[model samples]
Target: MTTLPTRTDKKLGLVIDLDICVGCHACVTSCKEWNTGGYSAPLTDYDPYGADPDGAWLNRVHTYEIANDHFTGTVHFPRSCLHCEDAACVTVCPTGASYKRAEDGIVLVNPDTCIGCKLCSWACPYGAREYDHDQGVMKKCTLCVDRIYNETLPEEDRTPACVRACPTGARAFGDLGDPDSTVSQSVNDRGGFDLMAEMGYKPVNKYLPPRKGTDRAPVTNVAPAPEQTGSPIEKLFAWADRALSR
Candidate 1:
């Protein structure tokens, strides 16, 4: 069994804003492309191009038509590995394959050491692991560790592929350990929250709740337009004008 580090030098993670995400799935595609050849082995597909297509994907966006007092609209929730501080996935691995980096607190599985056991998958509350049927191993999001630390690329391009490809800039990456970091500040200002704080996993990734848009209804307690007393011909013209204005 593996034990988590007492502490990490840096808590690097992603902050996702629920308000701005547009459900484009660009992050999902980019993650698949980069990790397939960069850090992990080629992602496998089963019966793809057939009636029953199935494949492994590290990232996915779920669309929800949520309704509440504040807002009611389509919300796109992008989910992946949260890389928790008290990662049950790591501790549950019997082969010592699952580990968390002490330098950055990034949880990862050693493909060589893994025994194709589903303990890590069962332990993860977020359902972030994917089983590669062809390779007989489990796969998951690595936070693009290879790209983040790559010195060959431009400094600005060192972020994860998901962060780079996000069209709406809903995803952000930074050292969440630092109180002064932009991610931390955004979390503070926007009321960012963990996916399941009650579980006590202490997930590093934070999600910003959707904010009420200004363009929505009830623009400062606006009253309905008053009905005007007029001739039948005048009233019809006024109604037409009001409809056109709307």
Candidate 2:
């Protein structure tokens, strides 16, 4: 019998459409739930239902309001690990735990080799790496490697939980190396852009452009023109001028 090809040797990535995102934070919450439950370690919260709260979250959505003469808009930016092509996080790992896969190009952490050094977190500018205090190591988005290959899970549910939980359907997951993938097609069609592209991290994630000129409503509340008014002083001046002319 001949061996069939498996879904491997492909670099997967995400394309987030900010224009249609409703800012519900479903992706953020869902990610927390999945990682905290199934991963090697769960995200820890310092305080729950207390005066102040702190915890680890792989993803966060930021809201921005941009106003200008030519355009006005509201942007919902869902931020997470960029999984850069030139990932500094991979190079700084002394234990060789943080490494990139040459086959699929996904950055991952091998917990067994990690020594709990904090250098990798500092090397990443996007703040993607999270310290796993319980495991005595660092953790981050594995790009849902286990779920994507799990035969028990339905074929339709093979992607990251965040992508699945997105109510607005703003998140896309697929092979970035394949030029024909849906993510690549969308990026070409809609003109997707990278965040902090100048840094040359070459993030695997892409962002859809914000809707143009949709921030504020039209200028309907403009001040009404001054009502037809002739003050007493104006009328007196006019009368005096008329009399002097006569």
Candidate 3:
């Protein structure tokens, strides 16, 4: 069994806004492109073009439709490793290949030491872990550990690839340990919440809930004109002429 650090000086994580995510999958594609040749190289795809294709991905987007008498809309959820403060995935690893960093609290798997055990994936509640059949090892999102602190990259480009790629500005990354950080302030203002808090993983990543649509004025319903104005055939032809002129 592995042990986690009692405390860390910094807790670097993501803050995702559910209201802004458009389900574009840009973050997903960019993450795959950067990480395939990055820290966890070659996020292998088995028969990607075939009828049944699967691959290891660090980030994924899920869309769900919500409907009721009063409200109906789509929710785009982007999920990845939360880098929990009390990570069960690390504790359950028998090979000690999975560990959380004491410096920044980023959970990582040492592929060289991993023995292709699936325990880490089972232990993770978020289903963030992915097993690479070719490498015979479990892999997951490392918060782009290789990019964040690299001096070679420009200062503006030091954040995670997903954060950089999100066009709607739905994703944000920063040190959660600092109360004064912009990400923390956004979480505070928006009442950002963790997923499955009941499981007690204490995930560092926060999600800003979708804003209520009630504040916006309701759409006015326009009724069609009565057939008494003209015969049905004549009305149809008139509508077509008006549409073409417009």
Model 1 CA deviation exceeding 4 Å by range: 214-246
- TM-score sort, best first: 1, 3, 2
Per-residue CA lDDT of model 2 for 1-246, tens digit only, reads 011122337767889998888889998898888887755456776676799977777888889987776446677888888777878788777778887777676788787778889898998888888886656788788777777777999999889989999988999998877889999999988889988888887788888886565355576778887675699987898799999999
| lDDT, each prediction | 0.91, 0.80, 0.93
Runs in model 2 with CA error above 4 Å?
1-8, 68-70, 214-246
Lowest summed lDDT across 10 adjacent residues in model 2 is found at 1-10
lDDT of 1 by residue, 23-89 (tens): 9999999999998887767788899899999888899999999889877888999999998999999
What is the overall TM-score of model 2 with all chains considered together?
0.80
What's the best-to-worst order under lDDT?
Answer: 3, 1, 2
Error of 3 at 172 (Å): 0.4
lDDT of 3 by residue, 1-246 (tens): 379999988999999999889999999999999989988888999999999999999999999997765546898999999999999999999999999999999999998899987999999999999999999998899899989998999997899999999999999999998999999999999999999999999999999987777857598889996757678888899899999999
For model 2, the local distance difference test gives 0.80
